[model samples]
Target chain A: MTVNIISISQITSYLRELLENDVMLSDIWVLGEVSNLKRASSGHYYFTLKDDAAALDVAMWRTYTSRLTHNLQNGDAVLAHGRVSIYEPSGRLQFYVDMLQPAGVGLLHARFEELKQRLAAEGLFDESRKRPLPPLPHRIGIATSAQAAALRDILTVLARRYPLVEVVLSPCLVQGERAPDSISAALYRLYAQDVDLIILARGGGSIEDLWCFNEEIVARTVFASPVPVITGVGHETDTTIVDYVADVRAATPSAAAEQAVPDMAVLAEAVTVLRQQLDEAMSAQLWMHQNALHSATATLQRQNPALWLARSRQQVDDLVQRATRQVRYLTERRQLQLDGLRQQLITLSPYATLHRGYAVVQRTSDGGVVTAPAQVQRGERLRLTLRAGELAAVAAPPAPIEEQHTDD
Target chain B: MTETSTETYETLYTRLQETVAQLEVGNLPLAEALALYEQGVQLAAACQRLLDSAELRVQQLQSDQPDDQ
Candidate 1:
């Protein structure tokens, strides 16, 4: 065999090509414990992934490094996914890692738990810190990916339930490395908008795909949002840190929309009920006043002075007629009695003897019945009484009366 | 019947509720009660109009770009 002399560059170049071309090694995952992790000022990440039997050097460029959900540290068992390649100048083989995650327990999950605990301890996830959602929100702000199916679902649900709500969408990246910042910034934008409530929603996805809402920045932003925040991340089973911090949590993006708006049919039913109540109240009030007015009318009739005066006038007229009849009867009886007594007196009077042509002499000094001669005076003037008139005569009656009395 | 856009559905609903309460207390004069009833009816009609006239409106903020569907 002829020995071919090759320069070191040629050898390194050949090795680089050999490792770069292998389909399996080009994209592979290595499970190991991390060690000697370093971040350069250039934003590149250098780390070692090792197992008991072997070790691998890993280098992730700044662009991919910034996308890491969890920080890499020594002794963290991880699965690094990337291509295996050689640095020709250093003559060392390394893994150019694009993604790194904890193997036994996901690094992202561990970070999520750690953050959840920290925020919980800080009272960011306290139930008391949660705000009550508006019962009927007129304006709603949505922080989500504009192109996401979740957005479409939310819009559809809102339109179906209550279309009065005006939606302000603050679109952001809902996945990948830049998602956390993008979501946080979107929340800030929505916060400034004049909206009654906010819905931070995303469709169902794997934990890694939905990791942005699990970030501390997103959690804090949701907590500090001026308008109440309703979160619907991933699925019902996938609860995020922001969900704990948000004012309300829904099972799905459509559910978040339901929470943010009131149902029109239900509201209409309520209004109808209220209208009935108002009608009843108005009628009741009117009925009460009508009863009062009726009683007042009855009382006025009972106490009417005009009617009482007419009754009193009738009573006075009856009394006057009765008294006048009694007085007239009494006067007639007295006049009849007086006339009979006067006739009796005329029948018994001595004037009847004078009217029968019997003359009597009487003393003028005293008028006395000459029944007894002893009662007559010798020259006394006497008067004979008659019913019509009285006559005066001188009396020789003493001699005559004496003769008559002697005979009796 | 007035411009529905000027007032929010929430405000109109709240006012209607208050008017209902006032009517429910049942002590107002007939004229006042009638006036309140008229107002309540108007509010309910306005609310219905608002609900009937509303359309789902979606607006996108320009600061952040959304990803491809």
Candidate 2:
């Protein structure tokens, strides 16, 4: 018996379908460490899932990618569930991932937590300490390289949404060896220029590419900035130290720009609303004045000259009602304030301390109280604070009272 | 709106400075402090409105940009 030869494509295609259709392999689960995890612009994730023995190529399309909870990173131990299929074109078998979870706590997770705890104890992320970014900043200074896409994106957004924001680009290295120093100096320079706000931004990249933001120098720089600082370090999936120290953190460069300034459209809408409210209030006031004037005229027409004179006096008295009300209202308010001040003064007065029966022992050196027993030495001169008035005295040691008690 | 509730930026800064000054040397009278605090609250609200407006505006400004901001 003889077998006919097939083309290369035919064999691979047959093998592809055979492996793809294998019931057990069709829907499978894989446990491996992720390597070379790259998220492309299209939202597809391409990576290698490897164990000690072998590695399998894997691709996660955007649709299924959203379902995955854990962020994928190189060397992350993960469990992937997907359909095992062969790429017919490349004749290479790859996994189409549908789910992924971290295997216990990964190294990155541990490091992230450790850094978080250290920074938290150092009060870096304190909300009370977080300065609010200025709105309608006259000039927004950016600390990023002139050539970066982040700068372009920021400039483009500012020009489009808020032309009023005078942007000052403090161009500096966002990454690489000199990035940390450059970033810190750039911040100082912007601060010196009295920029209303500062933005530290960079496009997403590898851990090393974003290492500049993760540096101690960068974190300290962000922490000490007098001008509110915003950090746009990397993609949403990535977190860095600078992000923690920043007054506000943006997942991306453009977000940093958004976080740094106020929207013009919203401001316009607010102004419009205020204007409408003012108009309504003014109209209501006008209506009230018109009704008052009409009432007064009717009263005048109803009376003869002498009668009208009396009536006019009555109207004038009536007008005083408003003035009287205003005076009473102001007086009541002032009385309330004055009463409060008096009460406060009573509480703070030295006489109040006398009422509390707390006496101050003053030293002869000065009129100040001798608070500590050690402050006075035997045979030394001292003064006393009495409920009535200040009294001069000589410092004396306790007369053997403790010794007498001990003897008894 | 009441002027008390709509303090400007300078007034807010003045209130902050006053609070710091009051906090520094000695205690303020409780009643006087209550009034000051109420005024401080108005100042705080005004300041917060500014901050919130700034944040919201930034969000709006960058909402359509080519980055994840």
- Best by lDDT, which number? 1
Chain A TM-score per candidate? Answer: 0.55, 0.48
lDDT of 1 by residue, A247-291 (tens): 999989988988888888998898888778878888888898899
Regions more than 4 Å wrong, model 1: A1-105, A310-408, B1-4, B64-69
Of the true interface contacts, the fraction found in model 2 is 0.00
lDDT, candidates in the order shown: 0.84, 0.72
TM-score of 2: 0.43
Worst 10 residues of 2 chain A by lDDT: A274-283
TM-score of each: 0.60, 0.43
In model 2, pairs of residues that clash are A255-B69, A262-B57, A263-B57
iRMSD, model 1, in Å = 1.9
The alpha-carbon lDDT assigned to residue A50 of candidate 1 equals 85
Clashing pairs in 1: A361-A395, A362-A381, A362-A382, A363-A380, A363-A381, A363-A382, A364-A380, A364-A381
Candidate whose TM-score is highest: 1
lDDT of 1: 0.84
